[model samples]
Target: MKDLFSSYRIKELELKNRIVMPPMCQYSVEAKDGIPNSWHQHHYVSRAIGGTGLVIVEMTDVEPDGRITDHDLGLWSDDQIDAFSKIVKEVHRYGAKIGIQIAHAGRKAQDAETPVAPSAIAFDETFKTPRALETEEVKGIVDKFRASVRRAVQAGFDAIELHGAHGYLIHQFLSPITNRRDDEYGKDLTKFGVEVIQAAKSEMPASMPLIMRISAREYVEGGYGLEESIAFSKVFKEAGVDMFHVSSGGEGPIGAAGRPGTHASYQTPLAREIKKALDIPVIAVGRLDDPILANSIIGNEEADLVAVGRGMLRNPYWALEASQALNKKVAVPVQYERGFRH
Candidate 1:
């Protein structure tokens, strides 16, 4: 009988409510040195003030070149830890827990002079053909992942999410369409992601939960779908993943046979499938802008949490508004009480 307003917990991470603000890339860093600036501070802290139970910072890379753009965030260097810590501290003040999505864009790194991938695949004609990582180099990237998670741990984040969806580095390794190598990593599609998961967990506190964002189905033909994803998800679960952020697409361009998910809660069924099939908790995302629909996902036991992406971008206080609309009592700042008077 839980709804969006219910508190939830896993291991050490406790959320005050079920509303999550999923990681959406800001691409707003000014230094081009992969450091988050004032923009990120205001962006995240505002959502925390707006009543989000959990606010996941965007795709932060493990290396400078691992980013999609020069402006993206990175935790490769210890110097970058303070800026993130500042955000996490302010978010905690507002009673919302914060998490960061650590990732490497891989072949999708738009600004890399030369990108790296599981194989030498160009995302498309417009993208550069990527250099495949040598077998030894793949292990090196795993170390980089471990380092990034370490920095996040130092930054005081309640949780960490490894991005394995959206045709990113981890996704590139997971997909047969992009991974054509004969190495052990290619031989076992889940190896890279599994290693990354294990490494991230090593740096996290025993109570801190580790979440992974994974595409449950690839859109392109010949690509793996729900069944294949479930198999690999089980591998990740055994590898120390506490939760799954179920999403779809990102392998290739959507074709006639592989259309994008456009309807509201279109991706909720996929989350439900994984939760039932694997008995693992999942965060249902994708066009879940309506608070009522998001709440139902929780009430129906469809998902453990619901992430509102674009809706949050449009309204930093989307959670607060949803609470009002749902007639659910939620904490509002004393200063903003007049504004939210019912």
Candidate 2:
């Protein structure tokens, strides 16, 4: 049976194992110019050395104002390519394939003078209300996604993940909770995402797989659940998405009754449903820090891959430690092998 330490491959990307370092924002770009610095290079390459099969970089915005904060990463300019290329080359050197999560924070863009979104909605009472995008302007945003994806390709990333979760721009367009527009974009919620996916695919090599991180269930009262997610995922798959990084919530506030379960693997069922319904591969995330639990999800076919977020944050060698804990054989860099010697 497949497990966390087993090899995994999709399209042109080949991984040493199934453990994935999913995109967790570092908020470390202090220059406010969105360039990757030594912090990013070390942050990612260290995970590669730690034996992670995949290291998906943080939520890198397509434009400056699209960022969640001034400290977030961006790809709006050609000047930023070299820094990311350095990370990519170093990650590849250590045997891990890397992908970047391209996203727009939309109304959640805390640092934008005035953020933009599908509708003029505020993320919450604390966020500024965003200006709604016109139909033509929405198309321009799609081009920005296209351009950012082109830069990611040039940077030598193995794959690309469009952030369609966590109340971001794409999510705003997909959910009626935020997309109250009367235009075609609102009428067909998947249109913006589909266009973005198609545009991204155009810039990527044919063998490079496209990954889409989606919120399968929004936790708020009126938010869509598994049924809605399955339907939309089907369309996404048709639009060139090779895999789904299944996650939930980030749409709106959760009342006492609407609150999500905090237990481990609570979101696996959503991933399982999407995998079964769409007959496509999925990466299950959310509180899957335990190696045994992460392994079980893959072994039982709940999901094809597992992402360790905070666990990796606490220890860059999370996969390495997990390998030792599971008694699985994984390559350790010669310099670090002594630390993991059996």
Candidate 3:
């Protein structure tokens, strides 16, 4: 049976194991210029060395104004490409593949003087009431995504993930609760997201699969449920999304309907649903900190890969630890093998 220690392949990207390090914002981009620094290199390279099969860098914005915060990374400029390439090179040296999640924070862009969204809705009262994008501006954003992907390719990343979840720009457009546009974008909710996928795919090589992170369910009242997400996911799959990083509930503040809830494997069922509905590979994430549960998800065919977020933050060697915990004889760096004595 294929377990967490088993290899996973999608297109030309081959993971050493079914373990993935999902994008979690470090908010460590010290340079306001949006370029990654030594901190990013250390952060990612350490995970690679620690045995993460695929380390996905955090939410990297395609434009300065698209950042969730001023400290987030950006791929809008060529100057930033080489810095990312350096990290990719080091990660590869550890026999791990790496990806970047290109995204736009939209109305959630805390640092923008005035953020933009599909509609004029603010995420909440504390957030700015964003200006709605004109038809042309929406198209421009698509171009920006394409440009970012091209830059990622130049940086020699093994894979690319489009950030379309968490009530961000793409999710805002995808969710009916957030998007209330009256034009083409609104009429066709998936249009903007599909365009972004197509744009990203245009810049990616045939071997480089494009993964998309999506909120499989929104938790707030009137927010989308599993049915809605599945419908859109089918569209995304057809639009060339090679994999879905299944997550849930970032649409807005949790309402009386309650939140997605915090518990181990809470979102694994969501990933399973999408995988079954679309017949596509998926990476299950969310509180999957237990190596046993994470491995079971893969072993049972619940998800193709499992992303360990908080677990990884707490222990960079989570993957190596998992291998030991599962009693699987996997490769460990010679330097660290001595430390894993049975």
lDDT value for model 2: 0.92
TM-score, candidate 3, is 0.97
Which window of 10 residues has the lowest lDDT sum in candidate 3?
A: 253-262
Candidate 3 lDDT, 1-342, residue by residue in tens = 899988888998888899999999999988787888988999999999999999999999999999999999999999899999999999999999999999999999999999999999888889999999999999999999999999999999999999988889999999888899999999999999999999999999999999999988887779888898999999999999999999887786422123534667878889999999989999999888999999999999999999998899999999989888999888889988898855
TM-score for each predicted model, relative to the true structure = 0.98, 0.97, 0.97
RMSD of 3: 1.8
| Cα RMSD for candidates in order | 1.7, 1.8, 1.8
Instruction: Report every candidate's CA lDDT.
Output: 0.92, 0.92, 0.92
Q: What is the lDDT of residue 146 in candidate 1?
A: 100
Model 2 misplaced regions, further than 4 Å:
253-259
lDDT of 2 by residue, 151-250 (tens): 9999999999999998899998999899999999989999999999999999999999899999998877688988999999999999999999998888
Better of 1 and 3 by lDDT: 1
Q: Candidate 1 clash total?
A: 0
- Candidate 2 lDDT trough over 10 residues, lowest sum: 252-261
Order of candidates by lDDT, top first?
1, 2, 3
Predicted candidate 1 versus true structure: per-residue lDDT over 1-342, tens digit per residue: 799999999887889999999999999999887888999999999999999999999999999889999999999999999999999999999999999999999999999999999999899999999999999999999999999999999999999999999899999999999988898997898999999999998898999999999999887879999999999999999999989999888886522123653788888998999999989989999888999899899999999999998899999999999999889988899988887856
